[model samples]
Target: MYLDMPIDRATPHVVRESVDAVRRWEPRCEVVRVIPSITESRETIRVQWRLADGVIRETEVPR
Candidate 1:
């Protein structure tokens, strides 16, 4: 991760990394959201998505 990268550029990269991490490890779920913290000292990623069974799940990822 590049600390100098702008938020717009970094956001998608982080989201992609998040989706890839989940997809590669778990195929039973689909990612619907990947959000970065608006105000935090450290980067915090919040992920939300739906599973194959149509259940929605959400979790926070510390990057």
Candidate 2:
């Protein structure tokens, strides 16, 4: 739901908001970073997180 918002650019506010939402909803992992990449037709959010076992995983959400 959070990723569905319309954005003209990848601003700092947008990035910080995304990072906060990820941390709030998923408590099991620590968010390493939330990167917002914008292409011509879509926006992609790449989230890097560190699990409790020290494994780092990444997920890309395109909207």
Candidate 3:
């Protein structure tokens, strides 16, 4: 799966938490990759996650 999220100070932790939470709910689900983006003029973080199930999930963190 793929996940997109806004950039923020807690983005990393939130991503980790989300992955963990998902795993806790679905242990068979695997994480393929994680991508992070930070815009130059925005106080936001974008997080993207690719999953084994050929799905994408996105989250946004605002500062």
Candidate 4:
């Protein structure tokens, strides 16, 4: 699975928490890549996870 999380200093913990939550929900999922957003003025974070079925999922969250 893939997730994009927009984080400010306040939401940093959410990233870790979300990852843990997802793992608990889907033990067969593995985190693949993390792409931090660095645009002009937007706070964006991208996460990619690979499922046991060999499928990829992605999500985006904005702060």
Candidate 5:
């Protein structure tokens, strides 16, 4: 369960929570870095992860 955070603190908070969820669900993947961006009309989260096989990949939410 998640609660809505204020805009000013939302980005980082959301990113942290999301990363934690991923780690809990996928133990074989390592979360490298999380980038959160907000524009006038959009909010995006870019997550970079390293898999157990050593392949790195990135994904953006709400693309």
Candidate 6:
């Protein structure tokens, strides 16, 4: 996805797709939220989740 694009145009869809991909690939985790931090110079997608064993994790994925 292009980070240079406006947030409203691409960020939401990218956030959803990224969340789906992570949940699909990592079945052991449940996706809590996917947030797009457009306020930053480098756009970052934050994926938050809880594992089957109750471990919480939040990862920052650069666009």
Identify the superior model by TM-score, candidate 2 or candidate 6. 6
RMSD of 6: 2.0
- TM-score for each predicted model, relative to the true structure: 0.71, 0.72, 0.43, 0.51, 0.79, 0.78
lDDT against the true structure, per candidate, is: 0.80, 0.77, 0.56, 0.64, 0.79, 0.81
1-63: candidate 6 lDDT, tens digit per residue:
555787668877898788789878988889988878876456788888998788878999877
Tens-place lDDT per residue, model 1, 1-63, is: 656886666777887888999999988879888888845546779989898788878999775
Q: Which TM-score value belongs to model 5? A: 0.79
lDDT of 6 at 12: 73
Is 4 or 6 the stronger prediction by TM-score? 6
Q: How many backbone clashes does candidate 2 have?
A: 0
User: Tens-digit lDDT track for model 3 on 2-63?
Assistant: 23443464557655766677578866556544445556644443445456666866655654
List the pairs of residues colliding in candidate 4: 1-49, 2-57, 2-58, 2-59, 3-59, 4-59
Model 1: lDDT to the true structure:
0.80
Cα error, residue 19 of model 3, in Å, equals 1.3
Model 5: per-residue Cα lDDT over 1-63, one tens digit each:
223555446777888887998899988889998988878646788999998788889989951
Task: Please give, for residues 36-62, the per-residue lDDT of candidate 2 as tens digits.
Answer: 887776777798999889988999887
What does candidate 4's lDDT look like per residue over 1-63, in tens digits? 123543354246656766777689878889776555656556555778897788888776653
| lDDT at residue 3 of model 4 (Cα atoms) | 34
lDDT assessment of candidate 6: 0.81
